[model samples]
Target chain A: MKKILKFIKYMMTYSLLILLAVFFTFPFLWILSTSFKGPENLFTWPPQFIPEHPTLENYVNVFKRIPMARYFLNTVIITSLGVVFQVFFASLAAYPLARLRWKGRDLVFKLILLPLLIPMQGALIVNFITIVRFGLYNTYIAVVLPSAVSVFGIFLMRQHYLSVPPEIEDAARIDGCNEFQVFWKITFPLVRPAAMALAIFAFTAHWNSFLWPLIVLRDETRYPLQVGLAQLNSVFEANFRSVAAALVLTMVPILIFFYFTQRYFIEGYKGAVIK
Target chain B: MLSRKAQVYLIAFSFLIAPLTLLAIFTYYPIIRGVVLSFTDYNMMLGKAKWVGFRNYIELFKDEEFYVALKNILRYLIVVPFIQFFSILLAVLVNKRLPGIRFFRTLFYVPVITGAVVVSITWRWIFHIDGILNGLLLHMGLIKEPIAWLSDPRYALCAAMFVTFWRGLGYYMVIYLAGLQNIPSELYEAARIDGASSRQIFIRITLPLLKPTILFCFLISTLAALKIFEEVFLLTQGGAETTTMMYLIYDYAFNRYEFGTSAALSVVFSGILLMFTVINFKFFRAGSEGR
Candidate 1:
């Protein structure tokens, strides 16, 4: 009887989990079903959860209607540039702030974090003007330049760096290693996981960035995937099938990327938040 | 020939030079420049500004849309509490050592990872006049006519809020889940061995331990709700009286080319955000000290 009761409880838990999962993912499933529907009446009294006659017509139309490849390339360029800059600069800036004892170290760190309290809404127009004045109005760098140094990235790296045992660096220094050698040979390698986590955060942020890119990039060819997908949304307002296909295309890569790197997200948050 | 102290200082400065230069040009310079721009009539063509003093602020106070945007953002705060409540519940639900829990977590996070554009567009379809939501309601005999979720003024903001709530749940759920995991298992085991119920264990242990995470989430979500723009912009195009402060700032600068007024609105919005943040910090400190 006890065994039977345990089985029933397990079943109940799985049932509840499945139910909530459906609630979360049904929209994506509905879009998937819509993307494959073949010229049938899409608006029915009872919405179809599956396409009666599946076709690749909408997918083909999505590629034809817009420069999907160019958008994808642009997104890759922008996301890569953003990720490299954020991780590189954050790691460098955080090293001194976290490890080295210099005059004004605490003051500089405090100054960097001060902006977190001040909202950046006011910077929108001014940054745009700055970008234009720099003769980078239509360039991809303009999209990534302003946000190249993420304060949150710096904070996260500094936290991780502080956790590293100082003795390891001191031993390296006692062996006649210089400051740069100590950072390169001993300290940075210990914080590789934290750097990986910061990279992942920067990746998703840059991948999903829309507004700034839309404002900066005047040429259609330079439009990132998010901005491009938004353009498709308006252009295909009445054509739900094409829009569904485009959304699926944009979603798959990131979902796949997340699937592999998701463990880092949970672990990263655990390390960053708990302390 | 350099002293050890000076060499260390020089290395630190070199490491900082690039990042600091970028931050100054992008983050620091803009804060002061934005305020100065608010007091001038900015000309894009000549890249010049003529002093206008209080003209922009006076004009902003007189605009009716400004008040509508302000009220709508406050109403948007209605989502924050609901999101927090649901997300905490979700974090608990998926916190078990069950099989396929990671898959379920990923499913829930799809809306967030897909970015705002895809989620908004996908939702726009579901909320269409002949959309799935109405179809489901009608088929279930709940209502005779289809409710225009996005178009009708009565339901438009509510629909936007629902989307925001939906998209935010998974993001916060992950954070809360991390918090949940951080709680030592020994605490739960101790409670169980002491003849305590699950409810008692949760109330006595989990909630208190999760306080810091809860405070952190609340502060960010409150700020996010106030600064909401993408949903309003995508779902309704700021139509049907759903314009928000961020939308107004964007509209004034881009759509109307009123940089001075836009900068003024941004300053106002930033002040509002800073005030809320200060309040959150004070409340958090008080709560922590009370314990």
Candidate 2:
């Protein structure tokens, strides 16, 4: 009797879980179906849950109609550069804060992070004026420079750095490795997990960055993926498939990047929850 | 001796020199300039500013749109925290060592990484007149006519609210699950041995210990909500008085091309957010430490 009752409970839970999964999964699935359907397929009554016929023409139109490649290229450059610098600079910044027994380091670390709480919107007017003053407004440098240093990345490296045993560095120093050399050879390798974690975080943040890029990059040629997609959505009248196709194009790379780095996904969450 | 030692210490700081230079030039410098610009009429095109003192803040209080935005945002600040509190509660319910639970978690988390664009797009379909929501309502006999989910100013804010609630619940739940798991099982075992019911155990033990995680989630989510930019921008365009302060800043800085007023607005907005966060932190600390 108890076994049957237990089985019933398990069945109920699994059924509910499956239902919820379908609810969550439907949006992405619907997008794929929409992108694959014909132009007439979009406004069909009772909206087709499944595509009767699928086509790649929408994807083609998206590229041909607008400079989709430019957007993708721009996003790739910004995201890649942002991630590299964040990890590199974060490592450089976190090392002294964590390992090197330096004076007033704690005070300096806290002070540097003070700006994190202030919203980017708060700095918009000043940043815009300053960027224009420096003649960098609408330039790619404007898109990348303000976002290069991440406080969260610094904290992630610092937290992981705390658990690293000091003797590894001491051994390196015994071999006549100076502070920079020790950091490059010994400390860097030890923090691979945290670096991977930071890479994923920085990558996603830069990939989906919208508002700042939307404001700064006035030239369509210089626009990132999100801004460019917004432009496509606005101009492409009654063309849902092309919009859907463009959306799919934008999202797929991040998902692929995510799929290959799924292990780091969980590891990143673990690393973040350390505090 | 101290001066020599200080000089050497400063000289060894190569990383600091460059980064601090960048920070000073880009981050800190702009902030100071913004504050100063708020005091003056620093028009970008005019290439000059007239100092007007506290007139900006004074007029801001009298502006009706400012008041409406403030009220809506305050309502958001009050209500959204409790909504997420309920979400954390939901997460706790299903965080048990039950079958196929991890799948549910991933399902919940799927909407989070979809980016704001996709979320806004999908939700538009969901809330359209002939869309799934109205279809479901009609099928269930809830209403005779289709409701304008984002059209009417009345339902517009509510529409934004729903998207935020749906998208944010998953991320907060994940954080709470982590917190719940970190708890030692022996405490629960000990409580059970002492004849404590589940509800009592939760009140006395679970909620108290989960303070830090709750604090972290609450702070981050509130900050994210305070920004409240992308979804509204995508959905409403802040027409029909749906503008939040962040949108207001965007409008001033970009649309109207008023740098001085925008700088003033940004200062006020940051002040409000900073004050809100500091107060929250204080309350959180007091509540957690008092018991």
Candidate 3:
């Protein structure tokens, strides 16, 4: 009787979990279905669960109606450039703070924390002023430079680096490997997981970046995907199918990128946001 | 070779201290600029900002939209936590470590990362007169008429809050999971050994231990809710005059070309966020030290 009760409870628990998972996963499945459904089939009375007729027409219309190509290119350029520069600067800066014995090191790390308190929006207020003052407004460099040294990246890398054994650095020094060589040859490889974490961090941030581009980029041609999509949203009226298509296009890269690097992204999310 | 002490000093100067001069110029400068700009009659677009001494803030004091947005925000700040706490309770049920629980976890997290725009769009469709929600409700004989969720001022804010809750719960659940993992099972085992009831163990062990994570979730949620932009913009467009401060500020800065006022509102906005940041730091610091 006890064994039977245990089995019943086990079955009940699994059944509830499966139901909960399906509930959470519903929105994504709906969006995917909506994106693929025929124009007429999309707004049906019952809302077609499966596409009665799936067509690529909405996607084709997305390209033709809007500069989807330009938006895609802009997204590629800014995210690619921003991620590369952000990681390089963050790690380069993190190297000394993590491993080196520096004066006022604790104070400096605390100061970096202050910037983390200052959200990207706060920085945007100043960054906009700086960009215009330097005549770099709407320039690609303008978009990338201000955000290059992410404090979170610096902090996370510093955490991982401080855990390295002291003996490795001492051995490198005995082999005539100077600090730069020690960092490049010995330390960098040791902190690969953290670096991977930072790369994914920078990529997602730059990809979803909307408010910054909205403020700085003026030319319609120059707008990144989020900003471009927002503009597309403003200019159109009843192209719901195409609007849905554009959204699907915008989300595809993120979904694909997340799928490929999800484990790391998950790891980074766990590390960065401690509830 | 120089002694380790000397090397440490050199590294500190080069790596940590040197980079800060740039940060001082960039991060600190803008904050000061914002404070100064808030008091001035600054315009948005032209960039020829001149100080007018408290006029912009004074004008802000009189703005009707500002009050509405503030009231809307405060309502969320006060009420959303209870809503979220309940949702999290629901999530914990789903998060039970039973068979197929991992599948449930994935389900909860899927909406968390999906863009805000898509979620808002989905919800907007559902709340339409002929949409699934109304259809389901009517089929269940819950409502006499299809409610005008988005169009009615009475329901618009409530409708937006529903979307916010739906979009946000999954993200917090994951955070809760992280906090949950930190708890050692031995505590529960000990409680069980002592013949402590399930509710007694939960109240004593889980709630107290989860306080820090709960605080963290609260802080982020409060701040994010204050700056809830994408959903409001997509769904309501600040409809029925239910504009958020961020949306209003975005309008002033980008649309109306009131950079000075925009900067002022931003200064005010960050001041609010900074207050919460201080609270979070205190909570986390105390919690960490307690351990």
Candidate 4:
């Protein structure tokens, strides 16, 4: 009887989890279905989970209506630049603070934390002024510049660096490695996992970044996927199918990226946020 | 061997140069500029800015939309605790080594990895006047009318909150899952041997130990709630009801070109954020110390 009761409880738990999973996964499935349906089959009396007549006309329309390819390329450029610079600078700055003994090290660490206290959205007005003053407005550099060095990245990398054994650095020094060589050859590679995690985080962040890019970039040709998609949504407000298609286009690349790198993303998040 | 202290300093400085320069130019300068600009009458279109003293702040105090947005954010923050609770519940459930659990975890995290625009677009469709939600409800005989979930002011903010909760649930769950892993299984075993009920163990051992992670998630979620702009912009375009502080700031800076007003609002907005952060820090610090 006890064994039967245990089996029943197990079944109940699995059923609940499955029910919740279906609830959460429904939207993605719905969007995929909607993206394939034409306007005629879009809003039936009962909305279909699976399209009656699936078509790719919406995908074709999305490209023809707007510069979908251009926006995708622009998003790629901005996200790549932002991620590369962000991770590079973060790791570079993190080395001295993490492994090396230096004066004012603690002070600099605290100084980096100052930016964390200021809500990033609240600083936009002045950041806009700074970007214009540098004559970078409407340029990709303007969108990427403000976010090039993340405090969170620096902090995360610093934490990862601290866990490395000092004996490795001492051995490198004995082997005639200079300080720069020690970092480039020995310490930096050790934190590649953390860096990979940071890269994924930064990649998705910049890819999805809307407000800053929306404010800085004036030309429609220079707009990233998010801003361009927002404009497309407004411009084609009545066309649900094409909008769905555009969303799928914008999301699919990152979704694929996330699927492969999710484990690193989780590890990196644990390093950065958990402790 | 080059043992010179100056060379050691130079290498360190070179490593620091790029990030520090960028931080100085972009972050620190803009922060000071944000404060300075707040005091002056800076208009982007006018091509000149002059000191207007407290006029911007004075005017801001009377702006009805600012109040509404502020109130709306306060209301939106209600999602923080709700998300935290559900996320913790999810973390505990998924912490088990069950079959196909990885798929369930991935499914939960899908919306989080999905960007704000995509999430908003998906939810907007789901909450459309004749959307699937209404279809499901009508099919189940849950409601008679196809409610205008996004269009109706009464439901607009609620709809946005629902989307925020849905998107954030998995993100926080992952954090809590990490926290749960850090916890030793020995504690659960000990409690089980003591004949403690599941509810008793959760309340006494799990909840108390998870305080730090809970506080961390609260801080993140609260700040996120305060900075909410994309959802309002994408879902409702700040129409009927869904205006937030960030949305209003965007309006003043981008649409109206009132740089001074935007800066002033930003200063005030950041002040409120700082207050909350400090409070949470104190609470977390105290909680950890108590334990």
Clashes of each: 0, 0, 8, 0
For model 2 the interface RMSD, in Å, equals 2.6
Query: For model 1, what is the error of residue B259's alpha carbon versus the real structure, in angstroms, after optimal superposition?
Result: 0.7
State the weakest 10-residue window (summed lDDT) of model 3 chain B: B13-22
CAPRI band for model 3 = acceptable
lDDT of 3 by residue, B33-82 (tens): 77776666654356666778878887777888888888887766754586
What DockQ does each candidate score versus the true complex, computed on alpha carbons? 0.80, 0.46, 0.44, 0.65
Superior candidate under DockQ, 2 versus 4? 4
Best-matching candidate per DockQ? 1
| Top candidate (lDDT) | 1
DockQ computed for model 2 against the true two-chain complex using alpha carbons: 0.46
Ranking of predictions according to DockQ: 1, 4, 2, 3
Which has the higher TM-score value, candidate number 1 or candidate number 4?
1
How high is the CA lDDT of each candidate model? 0.91, 0.77, 0.74, 0.87
Chain A TM-score of model 4 comes to 0.92
Residue by residue across A1-275, what tens digits does model 1's lDDT show? 99999999999988988998898889999998899989999988678877889999999999899988899999999999999999999999999999988788999999999999888678899999999999999898999999999999899999989999889998998999988888878988999988888888888899989889989998889999889987886678699999999988888888898888889988878877767
Give one digit per residue, the lDDT tens place, for model 2 in A1-275. 99999999888777876776786677677777888887554544566877777789988889889998899899999888888888887887788788776688889889778877664444677777777778898988887777677777777888888889999989998999877888889998899989988988888788878988898888999999888877765778757678778878887876676556655665576667746
lDDT per residue, candidate 1, B1-291, as tens digits? 999789878999999999999999999998999999999999998999999999999999999999999999999999999999999999998898988988988888888888888899889899999899998899899999999888888999999999999999999999999999999999999889999998998899999999999999999999999999889988999999999999999899999999999999999999999999999999799879966
**After superposition, which runs of candidate 1 have C-alpha atoms over 4 Å from their true positions?**
none
- Chain B TM, per prediction: 0.98, 0.88, 0.88, 0.94
